[model samples]
Target: MAIIETRKLTKSYGSIQAVRGVDLSIEKGEIFGLLGPNGAGKTTTIGMLCTIIRPTSGSASIAGYDIVQRPSAVRSKVGIVFQDPTLDTILTGYENLELHARLYGITSALRKKRISEMLQLVDLTDRRNDLTRTYSGGMRRRLEMARGLLHRPAALFLDEPTLGLDPQTRARIWDYIRKMARKEQTTVILTTHYMEEADQVCDRVGIIDHGQIIALNAPGNLKESMGGDLVIIRTKEPPLVKIKALPYVREVKFNDGVLEITMKDAHLHLSGLLFMIPGVECVEIRVPTLSDVFIKLTGHDIRDDSAEDSGSWIDSVARYRQKGK
Candidate 1:
């Protein structure tokens, strides 16, 4: 049986349809990514799978336990590291893990051993006694990760695990995730707006938009679907619509005065397009990334909506745990 499975899984906040009908199956020890822009329903889907929010309709199961029919069993089998910080500011890092260990019913002896090992896994052994408020953003994120894995869950759900973290710190978190999946044989399902994170860390990615998944494939396969290199040009009011009609131009996009072309062959197409359109400077010529694929499928930039509510983002996890269920 698959470690995680969903059929027509969906959720609605009254009239707001956060997640449409979706079906998925994840194997043991696989890292899967749900990629999309803000309000693309990534968090809502993760919320349902993690049991923090009930689905409006449909069903899902993790580790052979139904999510709705067996929430406690599913919760026991999964751990979640949320998008925002959940560590207690006044508490020492070790104290945080100890609390989770106790909540999960881990024995005292096992708790000590697990806390030590988790600190080492996140490279925080030396600073275990420091107050978490004093720790850097990256350090806090790592601590949350360690806490999530303390119970040796069958599946780990990380929602924007590296958001607001530095590039170096994000790289380290990915390493820890990979190591856990390999040595411990854990299955992970993560959601993120960072296309590079999905491309670099996940074995498979599902591109979601408007409460639905538009595409699902490995990062390379999705890029390969682009067919050829891109020639992006920057000019005030460039006629991207006209460019799409040109030979060798597979697709054309104009965002923020930049015209991006998915070309059959950039070498054959660049010179002619450049000569035809004066005053347009070539911004870049390279293969498409996951970000490009999102744009190609969704017809809009991922961050088109302004900032998401930060308070709601962090509170989603903190509020759930504080309920003391």
Candidate 2:
């Protein structure tokens, strides 16, 4: 059954259309990724689905509840983790979860049991009594996740859950998310700009750009859609001007003395490339990654400043809240 579904969903802020005619369906217990560049309407979509923001046009449902007509029902089944931390600094990790349980109207007896289980699930049982202000970034993230799960929500919405954490912490959180999904059989809808995160954790990804979904498929399938292996060659001189003219190469792009070539057969063309361009410093042949696919489809780098800037204001707000506490 479809746990979440949308038809021509849209949201606008005066003259700016943040989301436009988006259609989506996510199955129960599936990990669905909303992948896109900044300003692509990913967060807006999540906000609408979670009933935090109303759509300007179109319709959506969460776990069989219409977002417009049955918002309380939809909200009851959905748990949201914003891109930034939402925990209270003065509250201990356990206290924060307890507060969430209360908000969800969980009974006192069940709340204690659920809190204990959630803390263990996130591997934070050892420090449950510590104030959130004293917790590490990863710990706080886990605590927030636990709080979201306190009510045993059927669908979880995580927006950039590991955005600014170090790589090690990010990996750890990824494992936690996967484990939670499997053990709880909860449908997960995550929005992120991180290519690796989507490739590694999502069952399928929907690529959004300019407030529209440009592509949707499994990570491997999406990469395959670009067609062929990728060969990255670095040299001291420009080669794209010549490489683009090669017989078998489909496309050639060069930036900062690095050439990216997309070809149907890398093995057949690699030797020819080397022979054609002498004194090449480095030649790297690899399968097309999510990043490569993103670039090919979008004609822009995935991690550019514009993408980073879209969420910087939220980050700044989070920092200010942290300082005030």
lDDT of each: 0.84, 0.85
| Top-scoring candidate (lDDT) | 2
Candidate 1, run of 10 with poorest lDDT:
310-319
User: What local lDDT score does residue 103 receive in model 2, on the 0 to 100 scale?
Assistant: 87
Best by TM-score: 2
Q: For candidate 2, write residues 1-325 as lDDT tens digits.
A: 9999999999999998999999999999999999877667999999999999999999999889999999998888989999988899999999999989998889998988999999999998999898899999999998888888778888999999999999999999999999999988899999988888889999999988778888889997987777778898887675556878877788888788888888877977688788777668988998877866766665442234334444433334333544565
1-325 per-residue lDDT for model 1 (tens digits):
5999999999998898899998888888889999877787999998899889999999999999999999999999998998888998889999999989999999997889999998998899999999999999988988998888899999999999888888998888888888877766789999998888789999999998778989989998998897878777888776566777887888787788788778876876677788767687556899778876776675432234324442333224333433554
Report the Cα lDDT for residue 138, model 1: 87
TM-score of each: 0.76, 0.79
Q: How much does each candidate deviate from the true structure in C-alpha RMSD? A: 9.2, 8.0
lDDT of 1 at 82: 88
TM-score of model 2 relative to the true fold? 0.79
